[model samples]
Target: MDSTSGPLSGIVVADLSRVLAGPYGTMLLADMGATVIKIESRQGDDTRAWMPPVLDGKSTYYMSINRNKRSVALDFNDPEDLETARRIIGRADVVVENFKPGSLAKYNLDYATIAATQPEVVYASITGFGTAGGGALPGYDLMVQAISGLMDLTGSPETEGFRSGVAIFDVITGLHTTIGILAALREREHTGRGQLVETNLLSSAQSGLVNQTAGYLLSGSVPERMGNEHPSIYPYEPFPTAQGPLIIAVGNDGQFRRLCNVLGIPGIAADERFCTPPLRSRNRTELRPILVDALSTNDAQSWFDLLTEQNVPAAPINSIAQGIDYAESIGLDPVVRVGPAGEMPGIRHPIGFSRTPARYDLLPPDLDADREHILNWLGAESRLAAQSRA
Candidate 1:
């Protein structure tokens, strides 16, 4: 009857954050069978109303990340609500919030308050910036992308700076928050106490930049916008095919040789201009025409099958829907059904274990879907005035 037995099964996460990053972090925990109770304000999460392409007059953004968790709506400023909120935090194993640095202090819901009240709670704080530095800045995914130079690197090599289509910084920050919370949980077993964990969009973006950050710091040179043309790799960007663009990654000389062979143009590998990775990189212009000559012959999938057969890593670029379908076909079960609402499709937890499988819990709750259940469990309704938020 219970399929939920992941490593985090016993953990209960109090999620006081809204929008993508915080909700995304809680979703990750939810995917792993953690009991995540998501708190909302009296007005509900800002994104709950962010719907134009609504499914049955509900926000898709709310559906996207809030699945597999319980939603509790309360006004943090209300004294009774605050007490109830504090009680939840006091019993929680972890708490995730994305409010501004000191915004929660007035309501006595900040990390300090929680840690002081519940020493064993792993309090996770997610923000646009760190609590200390740049804390006052508005935390938004696009703002972080713009400030962190990711936008500058997007789009073509010409016009203006552009944001990534998705909220990459938010997603990455959420991941970092997840990691921090997990790490603190692991360490709590040793010290028998909790700790404060913090992550933000700016830091996550900078950390994610990897070599891009190192290059600027080491070389005193700002990398210009290169579109999809990779900085160090040659002939690796998407190339034209009969159907559409076929992305190829001839990362090394060996891969280049194999790719050339797959194109039925092994002679190209012998050409001095394309003989070595460095040489090919330097002569991408000369090599581009020849590579395109062979690539343009077939569609992306045809070339994808051929290239894989030749032991070269290649894949046809897939849209979101196609990727999901492919993952499901291979038994990954990428989508899961969570409740409080009905069963809605969502991406399963990325990691799996043979011994400790994650719980396939119900869908994300409608506002206070858990209110009656939670109140009944706590026996608070007899002594407390409460109602469902949905």
Candidate 2:
């Protein structure tokens, strides 16, 4: 891989959004070598102070996605600061923002205005719902989860309407923003001009749940959350053992037969009730207890090991921290370094590109850290002098 010249090396991103979704998108670009100038307001992004577990007095959440980018805190509420914003956007190759639909318009920094000046700039917008009905409301992860029927499918039947602990919609939505920007950049190659790219949480969430949505659409029944059970496959959920429950994914008839072989009940594979995936699924109520009884002979890891060795998709239920650790130990290196914060470590970007892997592990910015530098870059005299120097 040409590490120094990954796909987005010369691209410049003016990140005008705050919090998760927008930041996540820009972080993807930053990782790919885009020079992202994260423009924050005077108070900074609201996430800056949102910390229960602070790292060196800075919010970990704020630092999570701010790596590898320069910070220029411009107060958009002020005319002078607004001028600063225009200057940065004027010089950018790409601009990403998630202002409430009308908010950035009042500042005359909407896509139309941006394209009028930087004709070839890729203007990406992230919204919660969209411009019409949801244009005025604030974009939030939890809100999207609730409104998009995602929360309806997540937890146990008794604890229905549950949401995932992590911000699934936000992360996926950010990825969609990244996709839009990349697609726009590709499109610009032919059009020679920028395009208005829009991505919303609702659309992202709907697409993210493609399989579930397909099942619901095909069956005409709202899928029920069976606490970890597979919606389409049988014996593909948690089965209790002496240590804990294990999730064994018997994907096909071969794996199902092998699972039966593991339990010394290979005859079950020949039985009419458990001969095929559909038959096994129909007999899951009877099969589940039988498998659980066999699985109860060992611990989670033992089952995991046996299943894995036989090429079966099986794992013990692990906590989030354990999962990260597991990913790291296997050379996945999930957590990234975001400079030293009094010995506290920074988080990593999850996206891994073979040709252009993300390299934005720099320190997250402090408030207004790049004011002077940004002001200098935006200065006409400075640009002229810099051009002369070049």
Candidate 3:
């Protein structure tokens, strides 16, 4: 990213984080123009070895979240390198880490230690669980999905619980961490002090579950899986078309009317059993076969175009490649080239800012690509601090 283009231009982030959650969070800060120094161990971040989807033998998993940041590898066990890390943290505006509870105390890189030295530091810690009762358990995304009741609600009740295809909770926790860090930075503007921010996969997952979790909490009724069917809205799931399945989301009476008109069954919208959304939801079994029969007359894409033209929400399900192509067709530049070589394809960050737009100037760095430069920069900053104190 351009060093001076974003609102966070002058900010420096000491990213002592690893794996998905922490790296993902730091990447957000980096995209926003923070000078994020990703301090990896001597062996590098673990994701570098996560393979099968690699480019030029480099893990795409690692590259996806590590862009717009410089890297420096250091071994905490080495006394000299430990001091270097401490100095780097002591001078950084923000510090992000995902170490387990009390694990950084030996290196004196814990939030308390760094915060004591750099009073205005915004420190963030991501864990599988908080530092309380579940501190010792590993923070794997799959396990958190299972524990957080997400896997239970995912698939049909007839089959065993299945985890989501992606590491959903990790991404949510990372987003929560980014929000916390941004909020902390905002709070620092007024208070002239910083605070320790903490987020975990379990807590984020609970919040992310949203309506399903709320249903159980408010009514004391646990929700179970209903396959592709929505618990509330009728005709919100996919139906078979002549060619392939198409999703028809009939949100309201008008959309329902439009869908019926496009399906050549306008009378279904006025049918007593399916007139209202609640009524349609209550009588889905009666309505499903009619929709199935009507939808079967045309291909998915044909129905998709006809329903969309009539202002009804409908779409032919597309694979990931097709989805990206659709986004490109609509003028959304969803993919970007990163690295100095400009050969790596990375997904663009979703948010848009009119004035302080995100920068994509840097590709993900090689392991310790900026080590010598980083050490020199640290030394210069330390000397400047000493001079100011003297």
- Highest lDDT scorer: 3
Which tens-of-lDDT digit does each residue in 1-390 have in candidate 3?
A: 134688789899999999999999899888888899999999999999999688899998998899999898989999988887886787688999999999998888888877776789999999998899999989999999999998888888798888998999999999999999999999999999999999999999999999999999999989898888888899999999898999988889999988898899999999999999999999999999999999889899888888878889988788999999999988999998766676677888778899998877788889999888888887787788889999
Q: Backbone collision count in every prediction?
A: 6, 2, 2
User: What stretches of model 3 exceed 4 Å from their correct place?
Assistant: 386-390
Check candidate 3 and list the clashing pairs: 1-362, 339-363
| Per-model TM-score on C-alpha atoms | 0.92, 0.92, 0.97
Rank ordering of all candidates by TM-score, starting from the highest: 3, 2, 1
In candidate 1, stretches whose alpha carbon ends up further than 4 angstroms from where it belongs are 1-4, 340-342, 380-390
Q: Tens digit of lDDT per residue, candidate 2, span 7-82?
A: 6888889999899999988977887888888998877989898987687788988877777778887777889889
Q: What lDDT does the true structure give each of the candidates?
A: 0.82, 0.82, 0.89
By TM-score, who's the top model here? Answer: 3
Model 1, TM vs. native: 0.92
